[model samples]
Target chain A: MKKILVAAFMVLLGASWANAAGTAAGTQIQNSLTLDYEVGGINQTDINADDGNGFLVDNKNDVLVTTADVASVKVTPGSTAQVLTFTVKNEGNKVQDFILSVSDAGAAFSLTDNFNATSQSIFVESGTTPGYQSGEDTETYIDELAADGEKTVYVVASIPASQVNGDASIITLTAQVATGGTASSQGSATVNDTGADAEDTEQIVWADSAGETDAVEDGKHSDASAYEVQSASLTVTKGSCVIWDPANEGTNPKRIPGAVVRYTIQVANAAGAQDATSVVATDVLPGTVTYGVGGSGLTQIARVVTEVCSCTSPGTANTGNVSESTGTVTATYESPISASETQCAYFDVTIN
Target chain B: MKKGFLSILLIFAFSSIVYADVSIKSQSLQEKIINKQTKWVKATKVIPGTKIRYINTMSNNGTVMAQNLVITNAIPKHMLYVDKSAKCDGVCSITYSVDGKAFDVPAKLFVTENGKKRVAKALEYKAIRWIVQTLDANQSSSVQFDATLE
Candidate 1:
């Protein structure tokens, strides 16, 4: 009886030990085992409880993403201080700083002729500013842009009056991760060096796990936008005033047939940047009026006067003659008149 | 003894039938930018600055429901995972890893900087994992996330 009782006790202890071991093994399998399911060679999927194999994960460091809103601009000639707005978006995962610049497109502008295009003077301003200053401020420092954040920038270009029509310039905006560097002197009023003030300094977050240094991957992204200069419109107008008499100048001029009349042709340019070259004015006498050369029956006018009227001083007058064959009077100006400048030509005719 | 052996064989066969027939399929997509708007396109060849999305579908064809199904994916090289973009259809728990070895919630994941621990940012995440509590038989579920090519 005693031997049988001891054997039974041993059996119970053995079962308990076996149960404990099985429970521990099952827990281990659940925690660390990679479970794979295969259904009759048709479907297969695997899952790793620990970091072994299932999905591939990689950390991206030094990812600097930047883009400009406006790709190009067209500026009309005579447009004073036109503003080209661009929104610089920081799609990177960190805060970054950017510098702005404007340069002539050069070969990129695709100019066949030596246009002598004037370099555009540009100024940088934030979105809130009312006006842009024309000094050395061109760089913009973005203090802290969270991931997927964007800021609007205004590029104010002072289009030179000398800029010809169809001229083009390109503006390039480059963004660089402001890790550590001396602040540029030409930065905007709101932009300053990263470490200029101790209290205002932003913390630099490293991109890697070891944290030995910030992972600097492609930290600079640049985009260029082209701006074309539009052409200026030019126009001319002409009129005549009757002179009652050249010898006896009357206060009130009348439209009498025998009265000596002075034909005045005024050539004026519209408000534009282009100059009108080789301006010439011609007038033909009617059958009812005679050339003031003291003759009748299609006689020629001896001379006519043409001068620049809008200059500071009276321009030199040139003498022109009327053709007897065609009964036409012609006057040519020597120099080209710029926009808003006028030239005048006058000749006398007597009514029959 | 022969009868007992037959009963054990029968139980083993029944368990095998219950655990079989789960299928998983995966696909990749890219986002195209047109006129300042975003449209998704199927990814064949990816380029830098492109946003990519990965979709994984898990289907159960067995007669018994699947329990405690977990899906995990590694962030591909030259890609930055978008923050908080991972999702699943059923009740699940999502977690992220910075070094791919260890995983934790986004707020709890930490990285050492200047000899101090700081919460890891979204771009620092290297991997994502999702745990599904249960999937009914003959039903399917999906998980997805977005990343940007570096």
Candidate 2:
């Protein structure tokens, strides 16, 4: 019986030891397993924050993002069009939120973006977008996007295509997020005559930028001659093998490429007459390109100078009767943004 | 015969296109904008032992050329006593002046076609040759002279 008692004591001790050891082992396993702090070089996993949408930006000094885009806009030339696009995400860890805005101070103040439709589009200058600036645009808010949130704002700009004569502006897109928001990344878009190829009857009115130059040629194109004044237009394209000769001297019609290149053109005056009003010269340079200097006299080749006059003022700078022969009336033009190679610029000389 | 017909068709198509195409005309003034020299003249300042030069610039604001006309200038008498020059052929003429004074100046100036001058003072001398020339409408000539002042 005593031996039985001894065995019982040993069994109890063994049971206790086993329980203690098993508990220790379970605790060790729990400590050994942990949540990984990093994935794909992103440390956000460490914080394990909300807002499943999170991004890691390599460049923290300059980060310009288009938080929102105005899909619809109404534009008219010689007027102000302000579109709202915000730079949302600032990626730095700093608490203070930098202001986001745009301006055309660095770029030419005259050439602002024209949305063309009634819903005018705003032009942005440097800050986060093309029209580089640091100040807040009108109606711009959100000094600091919350660490995980974004700032929303709009861009407002004034561009008068007519009075300004080649008016344009740019949209500078920028973002000021919490951590090292921008590293050196800013975005920009060029402003142009939005109504360049409008099909509306009023389209010709906007083309008034031609002034009085085109008026006389339109009348002369009515007459018939050996080389009937066929349709005429000024156009441009990259240099071609047959025509791109810089050495060929003077306004080679083949249309050389430039932010502003000169284009000159002539057509057979088949039914050329003083009354012909279709003769036209139009300049079609890429809207992306701009003149290096003001009044550079570099314009589209297809543009015809127009002369408009009231009873008071002398005919506009280029206006004349069909019979009149102006030095370069209706012949010179500066190019605007062109759509395609065919639309590059062409005049249809209709034989009456 | 087939090849000939094809060639004729191609030519017709090309001619039609060319007829309607507005193009650069070789006769256009914009096309003639080559780096062509328009005119030149001598300096007005005369000095010895200095590099002499005529700073002549190309026409209109360095953008376009000025055309046609004539002008006359006389070498200062103080510099060229009785220099051999040319008579005005309705184009150019030159004069002389020993000193840059009104009375001592020559009554008439001579013209230099291929202007040539010799410095009486020194081989290294500068003479500001006073010059005059007429430019046709829309034409220009910018002539300047660099020399040490006497």
Candidate 3:
């Protein structure tokens, strides 16, 4: 009987040891990497979070460390041309760099207001330094992007208020690293305010305005940055643009949600000037366009008729749902715009 | 009688199996290929006066996103342009479009600081430079130029 008891005790001890070992491991396997997104007080529109734990969203923007992060863009037409805005926060390990660009996809869009397609280059980044130039133009940066940095750019597109129907456009933007750079932080979202309200279009005829245009992008340099302005901050003040008119809109305009309808875009300074010297009217097709007749105040830098926004702004996509073919986008500007001032754009599209 | 019953059961099983082969359903998510791009090689545009400067754009198809993207070009000559590149200095670079516009910039030419033909890398096409972006889903990006064309 004593020998039997001893054997039973030994068995019990062995079982207990096995149970303890399993408890130490808990549920998930040990020594494995897992990613989680962070939460709390995070803005769904603009939030910083790593997946929970070490998955860190840099500034904690709830964004994953992976390169597939994306952001949304919003373009609203105020009294001037239109107000295009978006916010970006650092959501990665290393310092981040951002670039925003756009292109005309095709006839997937139409203008709500009549605009000029002449004498313009939409300054799309942020119209100035400390801010991304917000117009339809070009600028480079040399500064190092610290991890989790955040910034926003606003573009003020100008059009001569003479543009009509059948004008389509697309825009693309890129965000990346300022250092060894990869398209990792590459994210994209689109905004549109094109075309007129049904009643407004039918009521007003020939109340046209010229369309505007612009571009954006980001990259890295091993040596010193070859750009003039690496980092930018935009400061905005009140300057009324020419009012938008629903009348005289395009004869046939594409229908897109949130498209930029009639807008009055204006800027004090567009170029690198502190006093706000360079400002031009620009247009972007919500999609494809067909009827195109070049204008003087605008330059047809791109006559893309494909379904996607053909302009190569950095991101995961060119034009999301834009039908890249069959339409036109126009841009215009103001040197003085007071009868005495003269402006000339490159040319217009004669859709093939 | 028992043997006959076993034969009938066997036959029924065989027939069912044959029917399954004839009526199996297939599941697949198929999207039509729009613009398809083939192979593409890019060189850093660095040469100052080369009239024919290279521009970086999407490969082959104007709209289709590239799949199984590959880089057949060599280093420096076949790499993205990077200043102080540890691998290929002066030879590595990239290009970008202004507002997505397809404009021709200046040409790029790679020259070793030591003034020696880089036989070590065996880069292709005079060994300028290039890079490959592993795009996801419908992702896209751009390459910047170093030199303008003639």
Candidate 4:
């Protein structure tokens, strides 16, 4: 049967020439020759020859990017969007089209990029779900990208409610090398096929390699990626002391006129910050003092107390999460105070 | 039909007088560096790893001696041959082929892989030959090789 259909069409033409990355940009490469000779006893007829137009195959363009983040992304200063991931890769031989852009100006890893990240877009990773997908990645640039293809890019910024705790920003992303067969637009940039050699036109050979800010062969590349920030820093404080004074009935104690006063307020939170939730702590009784006298409503003390309302082991005092009404004085703490934690909130008054 | 159109015009006038006794040419170059010296030129376009070369020549125009000759070539299909580069000038003999229909000699080719047997590679050749053994009558020779483009 036609040699088993020509050996199954040469195994489907060697599997589409092993998937491609090199021989495709206009591919002509005809080269012929054949000859044969004879004469003494006679037998002449086989010449062939070539060089009749056959050259093409050019375009090596290249593109790389990389930075699918392996660290520094822990952001949270008001956070929104905030992605980073990068990948690009089309180390070209043909099918291209890239053009994406983003830049926090550069440099940042052990951090020092101080702040600047608000609405910084650039998407293109709609692989149907594989990271950055604010509702299915919106596709901002790299369209065709084949030959050794790669694509997974994103940047999506917005972390700025005044940015704190280690601040940082970085970003970068780049990509450039365009012109591959229009399909949604952008295609144009690709430039570096200068003079001579036009054996049938197929030019463009930049070969990319510099990245981090792009340069060598300049078809653009870049990488970087940072962010940092991590919120929650709290601190408060507030001391007060004159514990009991029936006219110095405990030695040096005197705020006079029925003395008794005691109040503390600490709070803390800050050993690398983040984790200060719920904490309340209020206190407004000063019409010459009188809200509960020697402890009555708020006494949760024991955060390693530093002496002001004195409480070495005095934790339980009708702790209904503490509260007093018109003369104020409230304390809440529904848990979270972590990170180098401190939390005091004491209360005791009677002076007028 | 006019005696079959006069035997197709005498077999196209006896194969145009036996194809005027042997000739051939072919070229395709590439090397290029220019002002810093390197120059080879002529290949109008080629990038995926470039190399090229090819050459060919062949002559011998009439009055006798042209024996055995041969030549061939093929290769081009995203290219790749280069190992030992293939040359040919005075005495001739060269050979190779993978499957552009059997040629031989690099200790008789081989190729099978996975099913074992190996030995082919010069990027799996595909065709080259050469032969010669005589040309005389005004003579000419050439034959070159190279390849790479993949």
Which pairs clash (backbone N, Cα, C closer than 3 Å) in model 4? A199-B44
For B1-150, candidate 1 gives per-residue lDDT tens digits of 999999999999988776645666665666666599986655533323446677777788877777666565667544578988999996889888887767789989999999999999998887777777767789999888887655
lDDT by residue (B35-108, candidate 2, tens digit) is 68532222211112112222222222222222221111222111212233223323433323323222122334
State the DockQ, from 0 to 1, for candidate 1.
Answer: 0.03
What is candidate 2's DockQ? 0.00
Fnat of the models, one by one?
Answer: 0.01, 0.00, 0.00, 0.71
Residue-wise C-alpha lDDT for candidate 1, range A308-351, written one tens digit per residue: 43221233455433233366767664456566666666556776
Q: Candidate 4 recovers what fraction of true contacts?
A: 0.71
Q: What is the C-alpha lDDT of each candidate?
A: 0.50, 0.26, 0.24, 0.75
By lDDT, rank the candidates, best first: 4, 1, 2, 3
Provide the TM-score of the second chain in candidate 4: 0.35
Give me the candidate number with maximum DockQ. 4
Model 3 C-alpha lDDT per residue in residues B1-150, reported as the tens digit of each score:
999999999998776543100001111111222367432222111111111122222222222222222111111111222222212112323322121122112232323548774322211122222333332223333322222111
CAPRI verdict (incorrect, acceptable, medium, high) for model 2? incorrect
* Candidate 4: tens digits of C-alpha lDDT, residues B69-140: 787777777788889989988888888878876778877788887899977878887788787878877778
- For model 2, chain A alone compared with the true chain A gives a TM-score of 0.24
C-alpha TM-scores of all predictions:
0.35, 0.19, 0.19, 0.39
lDDT of 3 by residue, A221-295 (tens): 010000011111222221111111223224333233211122222223233322212333344543432323322
Query: Candidate 2: lDDT of B113?
Result: 35
Q: TM-score of chain B only, all predictions?
A: 0.81, 0.26, 0.24, 0.35
Candidate 1 segments whose C-alpha is farther than 4 A from its true place: A1-48, A52-82, A106-127, A130-139, A156-161, A177-220, A226-352, B1-150
| Worst-scoring 10-residue span by lDDT in model 1 chain A | A1-10
lDDT of 4 by residue, A76-127 (tens): 8888898888898887777788999997777757678988889999988888
